[model samples]
Target: MTALLSRPGRVAAAFSPAHIGRAATLALHDELALAPKPGLVSFEDTGSHDDMDAHTFMRSLLALRSYFTHMAELGAAFAPFDALERSGIEAEARMLAATGGINTHRGAIFMLGLLCAAAGATQADGLALSADHWRAALQQHWGAALQARCARASVLSGGRAARQYGLRSASEEAALGLPVLFECAVPAWRAAQARGLSGQRLQLQVFFQIMAELDDCNIAHRGGLEGLAFARTEAQRFLMNGGATRTEALTDAREIHAAFVARRLSPGGCADTLSAVCLLHRLGALG
Candidate 1:
């Protein structure tokens, strides 16, 4: 495996631009390939989204390939937060264009974009590209800026929901170094892997773990606080009942999917975190 980080002077040769790009692409693929995801898109169904399907996700992913690579390159060059945000804006525009204005990967663009940049910074600073390295780099580089950004009122659905519900916005999550991803999602994923899980089973286990803990604004935006609570409770129940290890897991997940769709609820924030976990795993950062 190619290390995403190396000694400062040897950064360029440690990881190729294409390698960073592939990491992002593969992470998106892993998210999409996870089937029976409650209220989320998959190869088998559209989940909660009426405007997008697996193909729509593919188009959005194609549009973002260059964006992820560019963000990594910028990070490697020690670019500022404004530069990364600018690149993300351009990437978001392309994604919207590709999906006919549907917001398929906006959250992924922000979360994974930062991760990619942090990966680049870690390599540039001559550190190992571990999860801690990425977290430290993000805090050192853009933590204050992200906190400031969260102070402003959000015009987006998720942000607005966060404010209205008094829940943590994605900006706040980023500002806090994505505690949900590092402290919750990744550890659960690694434990599942250690237990010999893989593929969709592994993904579903991680997804439910995220859903159970995160105050997912998408769920709030669509379903309100009551819906968010209900969703969280259901997710907690799923995990308490043994998650993917149980024979009833798939049936239970499908039931939740049906319920969420009926209420127009989507745990998009959890989905985004899952993608980040997948990326970190791919880059060998989770360990």
Candidate 2:
């Protein structure tokens, strides 16, 4: 348990009331129209999931995926008595869906993160994985996890989940950074709080530092820009039970080749993705 608790993103202590209050406050905001904050996550309207060429689109997705898993593990660790944690987790899921798609392994990582964060796993309590490290792990291990989750969601939620996962394409991952992700992530977590006092922002305060530590989780597995194509081919070939073979991993190298072709739209995609990332970087649940 100590080792598990010590995961890079894990919190060393329990969250404070004030922190929780802040989380609740922001999470419940009425979708205020604020200027496009820039940081952390980066997306653009130009390319579809299929259009994400290496570098930014692919790398960001890779990072987001890992963060999701670290965060999910953190949430599952916290066995709570009320809905505050659970509700927040659900809200995180919504945010990920709107911001990050769950089609590819990286997107799945974000899903995992949202659920875990919602469960109330503060950096103080445990779940210690950096965003980068976590992303590396997910990029490395998420294939198996995605297959498993895809199958599970398919069976439980019906084919709707499976088809949606299929929509993830090769792009649409998040970029969780140290300075941006950790420095600003807590406020988003604080907003996630379901029920709490006014101005205390306990959830926000606690989440502020906690989400930042998640940076380790983000870059741990690093398959490189080339890995995205491989992952995509593997996804196409083997999924759930069929599974991706080593040869198929190579076969998918075409995705990278294709990435170069589509990169013309990077600038726009980068900007939009950044907009969402910035919001997430500063935004929290508190809902």
Candidate 3:
């Protein structure tokens, strides 16, 4: 049986490796459950990519479950940054093998994997598992390493696109302590919650907010600067027109989804940020 830990006004769960794994899995599930997400796969439909669907994402999730737990364990042990990077590399290969070479959760694997490690690190130090705490720990422990790694050439499509378009790569985001998540996405989520939004509506609100502001390289890779501009403009319009608060919000989102599919554009970076937001929510770090 899983153990639990308690604190004043908040219950702190025991830092079992499995607990960390479950958090990652739950975050992925939350992301998948959110529907009408433009150019992203969910239970209702396959977004822009014909190569992957909800089921394909499930397979990738299963393949990486152990990786999250193991990485957390490594972090609890205070493993070096290179060690964590190697662990993610192996997990990425496993995900590719499981999904027949389609890259579904590579971005999630990197961002969420680091998050799991940060969680473990925080727990190891008996610190409260809040978003601010984890973000600070992640920077303290791996910021330099991430910056150095970002300086090297990357062979991944997203990294290549980021360089070609002069956008921020995932590694750069990590080095900067995930500015989109900490600065934009999380704040949007909190504001939505304050306004009494919950469930899928709340999730969509956060997703759109991130999409509007993020320099999503996936969009750049698929549609270049013009495509990225178009995507940001659409997202900004959605937020300005009442976002998920209006009765017609879901309908508008579906239209956006259709438009993204038609363009073969995917705001995958935003999707990753959404997943991170979900993770933080699950961990009660958003509070």
Q: How well does candidate 3 score on lDDT at residue 248?
A: 98
Name the TM-score of candidate 2.
Answer: 0.27
lDDT of 2 by residue, 221-269 (tens): 2222333333334323322222112334223323422442243211121
lDDT of 1 by residue, 82-155 (tens): 99999999999999999999999999999999999888888777777888888999999888888888878889
- When sorted by lDDT, best at the front, the candidate numbers are 3, 1, 2
Off by over 4 Å in 2: 1-11, 14-32, 35-130, 133-147, 152-166, 169-280, 283-287
Tell me the lDDT of candidate 2.
0.31
Q: For each candidate, what TM-score against the reference? A: 0.95, 0.27, 0.95
Could you tally the backbone clashes for each prediction?
0, 86, 0
Q: Candidate 1 — worst ten consecutive residues by lDDT sum? A: 4-13
lDDT of 3 by residue, 98-132 (tens): 99999989999899999999888877766778888
What TM-score does candidate 1 get on C-alpha atoms? 0.95
